[model samples]
Target: MVLNERYNYKLSYSTRNSLIMIDTILKNAGKLLVRLSAGAMMLTHGIPKISRLFGEGPVRFHDPFGLGPEISLALAIIAEVICTALIMVGFKTRLATIPLILTMLTAAFYAHADDPFGTKEKPLLFIVVFIAIAIMGPGKYSVDGLKKKKRSLF
Candidate 1:
């Protein structure tokens, strides 16, 4: 009977440990998935703006903040491309999300304000995702996580 109880305790302990591992995996995987998808989608918009910035003659674009067309375009590109790349790699994710969140806000409110809901819907969704990422943080599968682990060991 003692042997049976010992085995049962070991089994329960191992099960509990496994469940914790699974939970960690789920959280990390969820972060990675969202980060990658959001970054890639934003890039679709960003890359074109990049080309337009460099390849065009006169910088023709909207100036939502009254920052002038070229300045606004530069800001958009920075947020969409540089920041998104940082978020995807899980490097300084919360900081990276700041620019992205700002960009989405500008798009949804100032730029698309005069347009229909269809125009505003996309940026609004992006804003929500970016906000979530900012709050939850990059999980154990990220560069930030690796840095944290290294720090803990030291």
Candidate 2:
């Protein structure tokens, strides 16, 4: 009877460990999915802006904050393209999301302030995902997770 009890206990312990491992894998997978999808979608927006900014013509972009059209477009590119790539790679992910969140906020509030919900919905969704990523982090499958050599910013 004692031997049987010991075997049962071991089985239970092993099962518990397996469950914990599965949970961890799921969480990391979720993080990676969010990072990749969001980065890719935002890049679509940023990439087109590049041609507008660098093309041989006068830069004509929305100057929502009075920062001038050139500066505004530049900032958007930095956030949507540069920062987004960082987020996708899971490098300094939390820091990267900051610029993205700011950009989305500006888009939803300043640029589309008077627009209908259909127009504003996209930025709002991006804001929620970026906020969640900033809070939850890049997870164990990322560059940030692989590098434990030093203290990270996030």
Candidate 3:
């Protein structure tokens, strides 16, 4: 009977340890994914804009809704490029998502409005993912983590 009790305790301890390890791994993975997705998204769009800014490519402005192509493009560059870097680094993630969310919404509503919903899948997906990131935050590993640590120290 005593041997059975010891075995049960050992099993419980092992199970607890495994669960803790799994949780830590998952949390870290979530952080990495969030950073990469947000970062890559920014990189994909920003690089082209940066190229245009440097006069490597023609700056194409499609202001069908009359929002002004130049203004829209400028805002896109700020949100997609600047905010994306902030999000990737996990610095002020919540704040970063605000602009990102607005940019996605503008793209979906103004730019891709004429496109069929199915055809506008890319912007739609970006909107959804941006919203998700806004809500979930930058996860465990980030500048936010450092800020949190600093806060705890004080």
Candidate 4:
């Protein structure tokens, strides 16, 4: 009887551990999905602005915070392009989300302050996703994960 109980206990413990590992993998995959989708979508917005930044005529961008149109556009490009790329690869992901959150905040609030809810909705959604990423940090399937593994070997 004692040997039988020990075998049952071990089986249950092993099953519990397998479930936990599976849960962790699913969570990491979800995080990777969020990062990739957000980064790719934001790139669509940022890429168009690139032409406007260097094109012939005046800058003609939203000048929130009195920073001048060109400067505001430049900052937007940095956040939407560079920071977003970092987040997508899960490299310095939390740090990357900061600029994106700020940019989306500025867009949803100051830039579109007077606009209807429809205009504000997209930026607000981006803000939420970025904030979530910031809180969660990069997950297992990322550049950050590679760095962590390398360190663990040492």
Cα lDDT tens digits, model 3, 1-154, are 1226646533466677887899987987787696787579667977687656557456676664566766667777888899889988888988988888787777778777888888667777877777887788787788897788789999
Write candidate 4's Cα lDDT for 1-154 as tens digits. Answer: 1226647534466677887899999999999999999999999998898999999999998888799999999999999999999999999999999889999999999989999999999999999999999998889999998899899999
What TM value does model 2 have?
0.88
Give me the displacement of residue 107 in model 2, in angstroms. 0.8
**Residue 42 alpha-carbon offset, candidate 2, angstroms:** 0.7
After superposing candidate 2, which stretches have Cα over 4 Å from the reference? 1-11, 149-154
lDDT of 2: 0.92
lDDT of 2 at 71: 98
Which is the winner by TM-score between candidate 3 and candidate 4? 4
Positional deviation of residue 113's Cα in model 3 after best superposition, in angstroms: 0.9
- Tens digit of per-residue lDDT, candidate 1, span 98-136: 999998998889888899999999999999999999999
- Identify the superior model by TM-score, candidate 1 or candidate 3: 1
